[model samples]
Target: MHRTAVVPCATPPRATRRLALALAPCAVTTAPRAWAARETASTMTPGTIRKQIFNDARGRATTYPPWMLGEWTCATTFVDASFPRRDVDARALARVPDTPGFRALSVARVPDVGREGTIEHRVRFVRVDGKTREDVGFNLMEIIDAYVGADAVEAVTTDGDDRTTIRLKPRASPNAERIELFTNARESGVEGDAFYVRESFRQVSLGYGTEYGNARVAPTDYEHRWTYTPLPDVPGGAVDETNVNKVHVKLVTAAYVQGQDALRLTASSNPRGAPVPKLGDAAGLAFEPVIVYTHVSLLERVGCVP
Candidate 1:
């Protein structure tokens, strides 16, 4: 499942270096009462993500543990991808650009789909209600614009409830002019230093039909589960100028195609305009795992901390 691929050189920008040094230590040294009492065995482990269903109709924003707070420069490498349900077929094994399954899974492109390599990005986390919460709006705009292109992403916005929406500019397709995406956390929890959260998204590719009904809007639903485990700090990893400790964490992220969206997208010749039919209860259905990415990151406290 692993093949060698090009890895981007590791070097932080001048602005990033300045931000890292300006940050003050904000992570709580001791486990808070709420965090210490909530440790459980259900947190996911690497290579252990199986088919398990749950209901999260009224999910809310995730509250993270103290150790997870801060800005981080992450270098993520794609591990592998597979179609557990639709195996033994050409479409199941197709590359990211060669198939619409990735789009249906709410993924624009799978970095190094045919191989394994690293991509670097920066992310920020801030204190909320005495805990930690990621800045979704800023993070998505920074990451996605870099992943695709600044010209492709028109805007990225987050609501008061933490729901995020991304708008894309027009493409070359005659029938479509733009795309919109709505995403939010469906469920989240912390089991000791390990944290897990499921994020659901609805991606709508808008077509240029004259009328609203005939606009050819294609709505696709998918979700991703991320499991994070903090690693112990090393002695020499601390910066001398800042005197701030760095936190390390192992992150495992799995993308899943909910219900029949993936099946319909893969079967359609023109997937961009395809209609996704409503299915039965989402919790009762089995999700198709499309991609699993794993990475270990070095997190540094930044001035973004509240």
Candidate 2:
């Protein structure tokens, strides 16, 4: 689960310094009355509660307690990727042998447009070798639009070269949530060969009880699965066949103890289910086939006060 890599000799240029600073922790504030009102109303039905939670412009329902608003180490492992038509095996896709460095930085509230709210997160991903080769710039997650009680949040990532957009929405079943993320990129410096990637994920949660020493479903035991697809262009620019390359699924659980100030989170994955074939080579290296399962756990502090 752990491996080490040599640090790159050179540091990032000054122009990129702003990005490094933005990756630091940030603080956000929310309207108290709005949050309290949502919590009170959510006690009715999980379905209605979820709708209300996402509908709230102030993001009151999704806000965590103050103690839960700090930096936490995050560990992610590769799961299976599936291809729809081809005979490709999902396990054969190359794996990034080294464990990617993950840091879930600042978690806080931000100004909302109209009635919708926003939460800013400074998430940084670095290569375990201590190199800045693979890094993400300042990313923003905001509830941009809502209609008839349905809400949508756009996650924008400016990676210097291109922009990646991730759209999150509530699933048909109240217990399941879907996150659709995609981007258009060039294939081989060709203008017409635009490649698109899409991922759909679902989340579920279980709760628990205290004082009486009994176990119940907590408010945050959620399971999510994301499927990745690649679309290629054909002649005439007409719609062509869609190739599904990978499917990543995970189940996460969170619990709060009677006297503890943090919520404990644990996540697991199912990597042996299916396989995805590899596409043509890129960046010089031939894809290294791999199939992996991962488990991650963390304790996040939570409090009523900011």
Candidate 3:
């Protein structure tokens, strides 16, 4: 009689560790052109145009030439303490300022961190006018943590740490057609770091251009997801359920700059989320959120002339 031996099915030791790392918490990571109508040049100065653009926090005016219309993509970048360490170039995205079609961009803490130190937020706008091009505007917001170097800053992952929420109000006008919004969130953490950070974004669009000013409005939707976890070499021993974590939402804007291009400049805001309880099961870490709102326009004109 002969007997046969069965080999046991088992994951390689290294493979098991790799799988664990793959399941660790992490981070997250558009646009275009065209034209339509033409309008007579108005004697309106840039100041007047800016004022008109800023009039309604929830609306936009048509300072763009009649030829400016169709679709445009907007781009923006944000930076926070939780961002992974990387080369900081002077020409980096977050270092740039805001521009036109890029209105109402901001950054802030949830509960107001008091005035400890400052965090920089930027926005920029660009447009085409005939063969010439112009950057409509630029701006920046330096958000300071009120508490500064306090324990709250160090234990940002701890529950009840200072947090903030930032908001942007679009400028409205009679000739304006529509508005849309989008955002991105990124974060990093070690395995035993005690807490995790997360982010959330929202936008609201209003319709304009043609039709009755009070006609029913159409809406759009946008959202993002990311996860963070400790690197094998991270010192804290790896995050577990016993630790506390924080979630932060960094908001960036994408708007349509009707006319020569389908996309406009991008804007950003820094908004942190409340602290979240950590869980020991690293395999179950996940990041997902629902987009609050989006708006689409029906105007047939370009935002800039070019």
Candidate 4:
């Protein structure tokens, strides 16, 4: 076959159906944009990254002008819940108010059912500026969820939803993270002005079993404002989606843990020691925090990497 569909649509159909995982190809999906000098945005500044692009939530045209970065090629049209609250407009509902990431649902159960998909982005922009050591000031795009419709990209087939390289950093403060080890586990966003990074994915080792406690993956985010050169009404350099400016939400959390932080997150798959990867599975013993897939992207920037 001549594969290159990468249509995980940034995954969000219940994490492509409980992790039937597969969609890699995109020249090996992620892990190359300087793989992780991301000390979790160390503490992003630059006037809090230009006051988080003036988070009017999606109003003042969402504000932009922090010196726009590089790369460009984003074409997403996901407005789940079958997109039609009469075409949402309270400033893009301030970026998916609820629906986890818009129309999101299916952390698997309890009358759960809601999802949406459509992804096309091969983003790339790095501007950490923390000064060398691979800079870590802020702005670190890296999307990559190709395949744009056109025959639903041949019906799509991959399901290996391991976050599909979906790593967006920007959280001066927001990850309240109440606690939930399954069923839509906890995660929320919109610390406005910058920091609209939502996430989900809790299926584990499921070649056909071990759902790793299923926190019901499928949820997405990675917000950023604009600056001098964009907003010709968005969609530039190709691929487009009608009126554009759309987003939704989701959530259902439950799972909980105690006991020395569950024996300190099972003795280190990263229980605060940091490096990242502290959920469950791989014998670390599952209590919660696990991961898998669920994406819905739109970065747009195919340049500037030097």
- lDDT tens readout by residue for model 1, 1-306: 111122222322111111111121221111111110112335333233333333345356677666666777765554333332322132333332212223321343221222224555666777877767876655654554444434334555555453445555565233224545555445577656467766555555566677766776655444455566554456635323223345555543444454443444344244687654334323222243333433455555554565
Q: Predictions ranked by lDDT, top down?
A: 1, 4, 3, 2
| Clash count per candidate | 0, 28, 72, 32
Q: Can you tell me which runs of candidate 1 are displaced by over 4 Å?
A: 1-57, 86-105, 108-116, 150-152, 160-162, 169-185, 207-216, 235-287, 290-298, 302-304
- TM-scores of the candidates are 0.57, 0.18, 0.20, 0.22
Task: List the lowest-lDDT window of 10 residues for candidate 3.
Answer: 28-37
Deviation of model 2 at 95, angstroms = 12
Error of 3 at 146 (Å): 11
Tens-digit lDDT track for model 4 on 75-185? 434322211112122233323222222221222111112223444444333344421111111111112113211111221111221211212122210211111111121
Best by TM-score: 1
Whole-model lDDT, model 3:
0.20
TM-score (C-alpha, index-matched) for candidate 2: 0.18
**What is the C-alpha local distance difference test score of candidate 1?**
0.44
The CA lDDT at 129 in model 2 is 36
TM-score (C-alpha, index-matched) for candidate 3: 0.20
